[model samples]
Target: MKSSEAIYREALAQLQRLIEQATAQGVEEAHAAALATADRYAHPSVRMVYIVAVEEAGLLFFANTESGKGQQLIDNPRASLCFFWRELQEQVTLEGDVIRQSVETSDNYWRKRPRETQLAAWVLPQGTPAPEKGESRRQVRQLEQALGFEPVPRSPNWCAFRLQPERIEFWPSGWPRMRERVRYLKQADGLWSEALLSP
Candidate 1:
């Protein structure tokens, strides 16, 4: 049997290999594939998907407080997210900086949301105290009345922030730990360079 340390080392090796493949493929493709996989495994209660965005200096997180998932982001802004597509025996891992979405960007994404979602945004405080039951219900009713026939406007709180990825990893499961990994670093000229990692 592999020791705990060995298992961890194997995991890291797998992660490194994935990064290399993802980087070579391009960030956009990797993100799309990974997100799709994530959606499949996502639980209904997982309202916000953890995203790591880059900034001028470092990373930020965009996560919902409802499930306390934001706590993980806060504690470790640097993360390695795994997406496993069991049927294909494929997996991808992303490790990079994360940041919260800005109000403006959030608003843009908010506008694309369904009216019901927009209403829910207004009903929830997001990282703030939950309102009293009566008050909450009253607010919901008021919003419904105000928007009677028309769709509700997007809330300032419901926008998506930008996450600039510094690195991404992609790996397909196999024996001998010969997984493929790739890495990307945003250079001074704003171009990303891709490199392979040893597994």
Candidate 2:
């Protein structure tokens, strides 16, 4: 039997390979995944988000702190994510607790983004009421003009969060709805355990 550390490494390796394959197969938004979060009241909400980074510890994504998902994550740090690749007939699910990334990390990422995108972020505060028609674009243009040649600054309310997954499951499609499911659960000692689930 493999040790917990080995199983954990293998699961992450498998995920990386799947992500690469999906991208090679021309799947649009290959990094996109459905993120599920719940508020303090335990009310659940889900939305699609692009997984910006896949680290050994977990995955990372960004959002406005005042957004619904961000508020929910702050209130209840646990969340789930589901990634599906129709072309590869594969799916991966992750459940984990989230932690905000450091200010420096967020700044680095924000600096690398295109200027227009950064301006759009400033103008489009997530989950906020929509501005009057054309107001959003105007705001972006106005901000850009005001900033002149200076680099766009990162929004104080915008940041990234890392989801340190406690459970990860990989599903490979099989004929006639039969699928093979492999799950890895993180152990108390910070390792992991592997299991095969009926599908």
Candidate 3:
């Protein structure tokens, strides 16, 4: 068997490959994950977030600054992410501190988004509200004319968060009641300590 450290390194690399495979296979929610965060009062909530980037620093996702998850992150920086790929029979969990991304990085991503998406971002910073009748459509049209052919500047309150991982666990399911799990945790000096868990 490979050493636990080797397994840990492979687990990280496997995530990138799995993401590519999911995209290639036309999975609509290829980069989706359930992100769990605790609010200032220690209340917890979980929601789906589409991860835009995965790097050594952590997983990157964008959210409205004042949204419930965003506010929770601001009050309590630590969070956890769980990714499950049904087709691949694999799941990955990561726990870490969340850090806001740089303005330039957020702006660059914002530019790559479709114009309509940018408009939508402006329209709904929080979850979409059920406005009375045509009120919502009215806002969309107004935003369109107001934002003609210009990059939607990243909102100061709407930005990206990167999870600076301290612990990572990978699970790959097996036949009929069998499974395998491996965990990797950061050491005091930044190296990762790895272990296998009985399933």
Q: Tens digits of per-residue lDDT for model 1 on 1-199? A: 6553443344445544443455565543332322211222342222324333333433233445332444434444434445554443467555455556667666555566667657767787576788876887788888999889986776543434333454445555666668766554455665555567776
How does candidate 2 fare on TM-score?
Answer: 0.95
Worst 10 residues of 1 by lDDT: 31-40
Query: After superposing candidate 2, which stretches have Cα over 4 Å from the reference?
Result: none
Candidate 2 local lDDT, residue 79: 97
The window of 10 residues in a row where model 2 has the poorest summed lDDT is 171-180
Model 1 C-alpha RMSD to native: 11.4
- Would you estimate the TM-scores of all the predictions? 0.49, 0.95, 0.89
The TM-score measured for candidate 3 stands at: 0.89
Model 3 per-residue lDDT tens digits across residues 1-199:
6664665566578778878887888877989999999998999999999999887667899888788998899899999999888877778899989999899888888888887777767776685566778876788789878878766766677798898878888877655646868888887776677788985
Descending-lDDT candidate ranking: 2, 3, 1
> Between 1 and 2, whose lDDT is larger?
2
Q: Between candidates 2 and 3, which one is better according to TM-score?
A: 2
Candidates 1 and 2: which is better by TM-score? 2
Instruction: Please report how far candidate 1 places residue 155 from its true position, in Å.
Output: 3.1
lDDT of 3 at 19: 83
